[model samples]
Target: MIITKAKPIEEILPFLEGKERIFLVGCNVCAAKMKTGGEPEVLALFDYLTGLDYNVIGWAVPTAACSVRSYESLVEKNEKLKEADCVLVMACGSGTSVIASILDLPVTGTNDTLSLGGQIGSSAINHLCSLCGDCNIGDYSGICPNACCPKSQINGPCGGSKNGMCEVSKTSECVWYIIEKRMKTVQTLPILNKIKPPKDHFV
Candidate 1:
């Protein structure tokens, strides 16, 4: 899941200021869960825009705004969008980009793309999981060293690790502590002896 927040209403109002018809598009995937640009949010926007004297023609919530299939369905269902003065995309930057590529009308982003991680709790906390396009967590005892370590070291605990905590902060748990415990449970502590080379930035 990607986390996003809606742009200020003041900034967004200018685009549809003099426009007669506006289409408020919502993404049902990430933005929906984040409470940014979901169906309810779009409806609220429509009401506000309509109250501002702009003619809000209609609104739609696509299953996944970034998906080509979902985008096609939205385009087919909302034929009125063609006549709209502009399309306000209440989705991540990628979703808005997709809308722009397919639509001739002016497309605007109502949200800012934050991260590619999912929700942790009440707050949409995301771990810095670097999707390097290749995963090596299996060799690393199911631990994502890329995100676990501040320095992103893959071999073993850094010199900064103290009492199973990171030197950066006492609240920060040491990634190597987690790796060691996991390796010990599986009797694979010998793997830690193997030194790993520095990460290839291009990779």
Candidate 2:
């Protein structure tokens, strides 16, 4: 599931302030279950706007607004959307782009699109290893130092490592600790003794 956060209603109102006809487009894909762009969220936003005395002409929720085929039906039903001042999309960035391509109306994002993962516990994502394109975990026994390291070092641990904890924060797990554990498990602890050159910051 793609994680997302809703934009504030105050942030969304300026676009439709003076417009007589406005449409609030919600997505049933990512934002629905996440409660960011579902029917309930849209209705709540519509009610807020009506309370503020803004003319909200109509609203609709389409299944997977990012899908080109799904948007075709939305376009059919909301032909009047063409006449709308703006189309406020509550989908991810990609979905907003898809909606803009099919509709001539100006598109605005109502959700802050986050990473393509689900929540694990405490509203935080688990195993958030942002694959930064260059991977060099083969020597480290498949453990990502880029993610585990507090400084995001790919070579060896910095001078600030203290008792298997990062110097930046005590909460962070040291990358070298994880690397050493992996090496020992694989019976390749001897590899840790080898000197690793400084990582190229550009790469």
Candidate 3:
């Protein structure tokens, strides 16, 4: 799932200083589930802006805000978006880009889109994919350092690891330790012998 968090209202207010008519957009898939850009959050922003004495034209929470087709349909239906002075997108980075591409108005964001992550349950999640495009999961028995490690260490720990914890974060564990333990349990340590080459930055 794509992780996202709401930007502080204080930080967002600066963008609306001179603007009057505002159009709000939200995402219904990733941000909706994350509670950052869903309809409820959009409505809350609408009220907040109303309290601040801005004319809110309209708001739409697209089912998939990252889809060009979905966002186009929303703009076509609202029409207020065309008249508004600017648009505020309360979605992930991908979704925000989609809205900006399909609109002629000034576009702004209200959420910080985070990494692609894995969900352990309904609420708990952890970063799972860094989208490096190299995909070395086969080398480490499906574990990926790019996703779990702070330094994006490809080979092993930096020797700062102590008591199975990462050098940077006390709450986070050393990814190499997890990889080593998994390899030993499955007797797949031999796979690590085929070291990964340097990642191609061009890709």
Highest-TM-score candidate = 3
Q: In terms of lDDT, which candidate is stronger, 1 or 3?
A: 3
lDDT of 3 at 58: 94
Assess each prediction's global lDDT (C-alpha) against the native: 0.80, 0.75, 0.86
Q: Taking the candidates one at a time, how many backbone clashes does each contain? A: 0, 0, 0
- Descending-lDDT candidate ranking: 3, 1, 2
Instruction: Tell me each candidate's RMSD, in Å, in order.
Output: 3.6, 4.4, 1.6
Error of 1 at 195 (Å): 3.1
Kindly give the stretch of ten consecutive residues in candidate 1 with the minimal lDDT sum: 125-134
Against the true structure, what is each candidate's TM-score? 0.73, 0.68, 0.93
Worst 10 residues of 3 by lDDT: 118-127
Q: What residue pairs clash in candidate 3, if any at all?
A: none
- Candidate 2 lDDT by residue in tens digits, 81-176: 656777788877877888888777778879987655555553644233545666666778877676556577766778988898888777877878
Off by over 4 Å in 3: 70-72
Model 1 clashing-pair count: 0
lDDT string for model 1 (21-53, tens) is 788889998899998888899999888877878
Model 1 spans > 4 angstroms off: 10-20, 70-72, 119-125, 148-190, 201-203
